[model samples]
Target: MADLWVGNVDDNTSDDEIREFLIKYGFPSFDEIERYSGTGTRPAVMLIFHDTTPDALRGLQSRIHNMFWKDRTIVVQVMPERDES
Candidate 1:
């Protein structure tokens, strides 16, 4: 599994919109998504890919990182693998 953190998203952007954006950039459909309204300043989302690898996500991360989307400059990062012991 892998987790991708997408920050600086527009508050009005819906989850489905984000999904479509990722798919348009060659990303596979994420398994799940979690939204965070951090300080109400920069909204973010954590997308979980159940069958994807961190390396794979990292490769795709740059496609959208620092890219302008929905009138916001987006930040994309592939989270480190968690130690699920």
Candidate 2:
């Protein structure tokens, strides 16, 4: 599995909009999404891909990292694997 962190997203953007944006950039549909609005400063979303690998996500990360979307310069990163134990 893989986790992707997408930051600097607009507050008005909906989940479906995010899904579409990622799909438009060649990302497979994510299995889950967790939204974070920390301090209402940098709204972000963590996307979980059940069947994808970190390396695969990393390869696709560059396609959208630092790209302007919804009036914000979004940041995309493939998170490091977490220890399940």
Candidate 3:
């Protein structure tokens, strides 16, 4: 499993918009996406993918980082795996 953190999302950006943008831009269908509640200045989202490999996830991250969305520069990163102990 891989999760992508998309930062600097606009406060007005909706969940559907993010999903549609990714689909429109050639991203494979994902499992889930969540938009964190914003504090006016800093908003973010997480795109979860369970069907993709690490290399594919990294490629998507590279393609999305520094890209413009809703007029804001988006920062995308592959979230580190968590320990299950």
Candidate 4:
């Protein structure tokens, strides 16, 4: 299993904003950015892919989240990272 880190950030958050943020720091591609619009879609989020066997992404999850937006807790999920490989 790998990981997919996301951010259900505030509504003001934009795809460009998230994309730039991800790339600027040290995340994967933003080409696959997707949007989920529900009644409560105020806070925007990103879908990141991490492909590490033992999930080195766990540490990255909290670290990246905390590093950039200390105010907001970026959301994360550990799963079978996409088979782009």
Candidate 5:
């Protein structure tokens, strides 16, 4: 499974908005929305997933550019599978 990063999001951004983006970009998501903890009212958020294809991730990378947040862009990364020995 893979995951795509959608962070530095506005708290005002709804789940539907992200969902619409994902669907438009051919990334079907099946996880609930997430919210940031320490930032008070306005906070960054991440949309995790079980699998977001490489192609989709690439597309998202282009779209999410330097401003995951309109006010400021935050670092976004894809988490690789951890090898468990």
Candidate 6:
């Protein structure tokens, strides 16, 4: 499993748009896509996939990284797992 982080996404970009983008890039189905936004800041989206291989995660990351959307370059990266403290 992996959580792919895509930062600097335009606020106007919808989850459906992100889904379509993922589908266009060869992802069969995503577990979930969540958007985070703050006032006066660019929104970020996280694409989660379950039971995914590392190579597949890396491939998705590479494919989405530097991709342009709404005139902003997408910053894609593998999100580190949260530590249970």
Least lDDT summed over 10 consecutive residues: which range in candidate 1? 9-18
After superposition, the stretches of candidate 5 with alpha carbons farther than 4 Å from their true spots are 53-56, 67-75, 82-85
> Native-vs-model 1 lDDT?
0.93
Off by over 4 Å in 3: none
- Model 6 alpha-carbon drift over 4 Å, by segment: 82-85
lDDT of 5 by residue, 42-84 (tens): 4655666656555556656665556444465655555564454
Residue 36 displacement in candidate 1 (angstroms): 0.8
Q: Candidate 2's residue-wise lDDT over 38-76, tens digit each?
A: 889889999999999999998899999999998889999
| Per-model lDDT | 0.93, 0.93, 0.79, 0.55, 0.59, 0.78
- Select the stronger candidate by TM-score from 1 and 5: 1
TM-score of each: 0.96, 0.96, 0.80, 0.52, 0.58, 0.78
10-82 per-residue lDDT for model 1 (tens digits): 8788889999999999999999999999899899999999999999998999999999998889999999998
Model 6, 1-85: lDDT tens per residue?
A: 7788889899788778887887888764678888888564767988888867546878767777898877998888888765538
Q: Is candidate 2 or 3 superior in TM-score? A: 2
Task: Give candidate 3's error at residue 76 in angstroms.
Answer: 0.6
Clash pairs detected, candidate 3: none
Estimate candidate 6's RMSD in Å: 2.2
**TM-score for candidate 1:** 0.96
What is the per-residue lDDT of model 3 for residues 2-81, given as tens digits with 9 covering 90 to 100? 78888998868877788888877777767888888677677888888887765777876767789977788998888886
